[model samples]
Target: MALLPTTAQAAQTHPDPRPLTGQEIIHDPTVARLKSGGYVAYSTGGIIGARLSADGRHWDDAGNAFAEPPAWWYEYNDKADPWAPDLSYRDGRYWLYYAVSSWGSNHSAIGVATSPSGRPGTWTDHGKVFSSERTDSWNAIDPAIVRADGRLWMSFGSYWTGIRMVELDPVTGKTVPGAAVHHLATRPDAPYAVEGPYIVKHGRHYYLFASYDACCSGVNSTYKIKVGRSASATGPYVDSAGTPMLNGGGDLVLEGHGRFIGTGGQSVFRDKGKDWLAYHYYDAEDDGTPKLGLNRLSWTKDGWPKVS
Candidate 1:
């Protein structure tokens, strides 16, 4: 019998022509559309870096933005695992809140860093803003700060509980003492896995968006984005069908697609008067490793957002 070509031989003879780029491995992307008409993004396990893009597609690496970890962060014995960063402009400064902790544990904290411009080498560490103590029932990670209705609010939590919102003093950017923390949403029945809370205000409503289920671990990931809305920033948020987010009330927004499993540590921004969604998805081209993904967001006539 004639010798037959093996799968390995075939692959070696005609390798995949598509080449992987720097963006392919970039995970936990947080995007900010700069005032200078470009976009800046930060990610995890890479350089503590930023990337600039004129068109929001093709990017040039700006290199390490704030390479030195804060001294307090190391002293607290927190893991160096940085995840779910949120970037925003406030008071003529760029503020970043990033979560640091070991995987699936309450030993986590959110640290602050600031820059006068949204570029590399300008960030100044502001130390830890929030952390979960051993006595607290909820796990704290995924800190997203939003300025709404003349106040600042930080939304954070994960599988041990759900998304919770606490008020922050606008000038100080720290939690206001005795300000009642609200349970904005939970998934007590559906495996109770929720985290990565990102919020946006559209017209008269405040939209609370978050991811549910496991991220990481490649093909075994069950990550998907879910959403709810409220008229007030301190929300009694509800889904479209009138279910309260506090009792596991969220409508499905985006979910996985085959190898492109949609994990949501998402951020929303407006660019040139159009809305955009920025999140990370497993790239099929790169053997299902996570990569940054962006898409336009369209509001339905009835006032719900859809990824376009």
Candidate 2:
């Protein structure tokens, strides 16, 4: 286990993202430290846009993950573009899961793909793993995968009733047929606005991180990231004050600050034995352009995560 940062070090740390250069523009990025060395970031644009970095600080645009969208994607949107991809490595291969949908519509699906290397243009599409329709209370987008107690689970949702989870087949990496949908987090008020769920385990508890409020409105975007923790993977998660996330409980993680406006849509990964938070923010200094945000994630002495 990594040593916990002292309170003095935590106080001196900035909540803003670390300085980055070279092709930093991206949205809803999921970054993975490559087994082959360096890193790759996949995001919600251009048939699943990709960026590569030899060193963690500088990046270069690589290209799209797929040359063309699958035929089924057109059923959700005319352009067939995918969004909010989540990438993970397991079972000796890389698994890429992404969502397809039209804005403001609940007709959506999450699809899976595999690659020997977690690089752009190398993935093989594996069709839909889960989906939702207008009649359903939960929208099937923004997936985050987590493994716990020897079982695989996927947490997803946006806008409708809030965050949800379903078990996945370990062998196929798809939703287990007849698996029950488990509610995770949401606002107590209607039109729940919360989205982009990412869960990470720390010590004895599972922490759920998610974005709350409006996103994608440039400088006006109100996006912010918050978190809660539960003893089990699927939970009745609560904030520091003991308020249930189901009742709008989440400890603030990151919010808009100065040049970094509307920071949210986050994912966490481990690199060189240290955990890092990866997300995007609308840049006020750059006319609200979406740009990558990276920050080292440290644990408090009490075990809660703190982004440095």
Candidate 3:
């Protein structure tokens, strides 16, 4: 997953998300490049609201991943609502992983589903993969998967003890039996606000990208994207100056500036040999509407990621 460095991006000015049209409102979005030549995006809402794009620029609503939540979802949230889905293609099928929980409660779970066609209504639910109880220090709300060393790993957590990881059975896409939970990133300060972790391997390192501070507060949201890198999938990740992530160490990647506010909840994907970053940001002009944000990701000469 090595990306060659392109021309250095401008340091002073940052690029805005590419303009989008039709069914633009979404939150905590995850996108998968479909085998059918278009793209489908799933996000937090009614059974996971969906959006589609033919060219990755213009988007349209495509309904949801499920008509109704699975019966088990009620144990966590009475509404049976889901959030922060992660979608990807593997083994000639589409695998979707998502989070289910109510706000401010550590009682949460991550669920999985599969689809022959990565369409909105075609998925088969696989139920809960991993979860956390109120007594657990880590909350299981945001799930992101990465395969390394012929092993499948899922990184997830929020608010309660930041980010954590556990190994998953590739065939089942569920946490391995009796697998030890590994802590990935967290703020040293109490009530750690870091969360929404997405990991990607580029070159020889695995980079952990996460959202920092408060989100879901509309224009007042302070969410921004940050990054730290490690040589191992389960890591003691560190920033450029060698500060460990457990101590609130991270290098700023993207943040709110001007009209685009609260830029976080990010995932990275490869398309046509180039990498792109997908996330959500509050639009200051449109009454703080949460909308999809995309940026072309480039590598710096030093092998770090730079989004333009």
Candidate 4:
């Protein structure tokens, strides 16, 4: 869903995302801090791009999330760049949610896989969890999952109708029966662009973060990260100004400034008592290549989030 930039966030100075020697060419990435005191990342690729980080700063290539992608993936993307994977561990296995679809096409599917340890080559593909087609108004991509109160929920969508959420079953790794798909956030205007939904429960509220505008155009990209929070897991979420997310409301969390372009497609992770925001951004100086971004996330006294 690439579009023109709204303002000049083009990097005129230093490139953000510093530069990892081994891990480059990132696209919509998700990470899991390994039990061995390192980090593993999964992102858009044939199967999934796997990278390893012992100290979170330096990184190295591990492998693909699956040794061979399930055959069904070819039905979605002919080129097969599997986009936006979400990773989490549960029930003695690592649960991975990944998307398969072509750009600007609604013929999309979200699939799940499990691994004993969250290493590459070890995942067992369980097949499609959810999908959407040409007839549907919403595109099923960029999936993110969160646990709230006591239930598992997944949020995903892009371009068409903004973001959508459905409750998930922990055991089956699918949607819970009788659960409804809730419309979470949307831009609702002419371009009507918003996507990349992530949910994090901080303090007494549930916060939803998403990307706005065009993504994927290198340094020319215009993506930015925004957030809204709700009292309940399923909401009527509102921004700092009390504007509802359903009504196109979001509070800006990060945007391109300096050399970072399109600062979005992010995930919130907690490590060692601190929360970290992980995402990818196009480099203006480096021909707009998408690269990994890591920032420390802190909460304000009044309950909003700020990423440093």
Global lDDT of each candidate: 0.76, 0.94, 0.91, 0.85
Per lDDT, what order, best first?
2, 3, 4, 1
Worst 10 residues of 4 by lDDT: 10-19
Ten contiguous residues minimizing lDDT sum, candidate 3: 8-17
Question: For each candidate, what TM-score against the reference?
Answer: 0.88, 0.95, 0.95, 0.92
Q: Write the per-residue lDDT of candidate 1 for residues 1-308, one digit (tens) a residue.
A: 99887755432111111232444456667888887677888876633556777767677777766776666665334545576778888999988888777665677777788888877788887777778865776667788887787889999888766888888777767778787767888876755788888889988999999888888856667788888999988798899999988888888877776456756667787888988777777766567787777777889988898886
- Candidate 3 lDDT tens digits, 1-308: 99888987776556898888888899998987777888888999878999999999889998899987899999999999898999987778889999989999999999999999989999999999999999999999989999999999999989898999999999999999999999989997878999999999999999999999989999999999999999999998999989999889998889998888999989988888888899999999988999999999888888788889
Stretches of candidate 1 off by over 4 Å are 1-22, 75-79
- Off by more than 4 A, model 3: 1-12
Model 3: lDDT equals 0.91
lDDT of 3 at 272: 88
The CA lDDT at 44 in model 4 is 81
Which has the better TM-score: candidate 2, or candidate 4? 2
Q: CA lDDT of 286 in candidate 2?
A: 87
* Model 2: residues with Cα > 4 Å off, grouped in runs: 1-14
lDDT of 3 at 38: 87
Could you tell me which 10 consecutive residues in candidate 1 have the lowest summed lDDT? 11-20
**Cα lDDT for residue 34, model 1?**
83
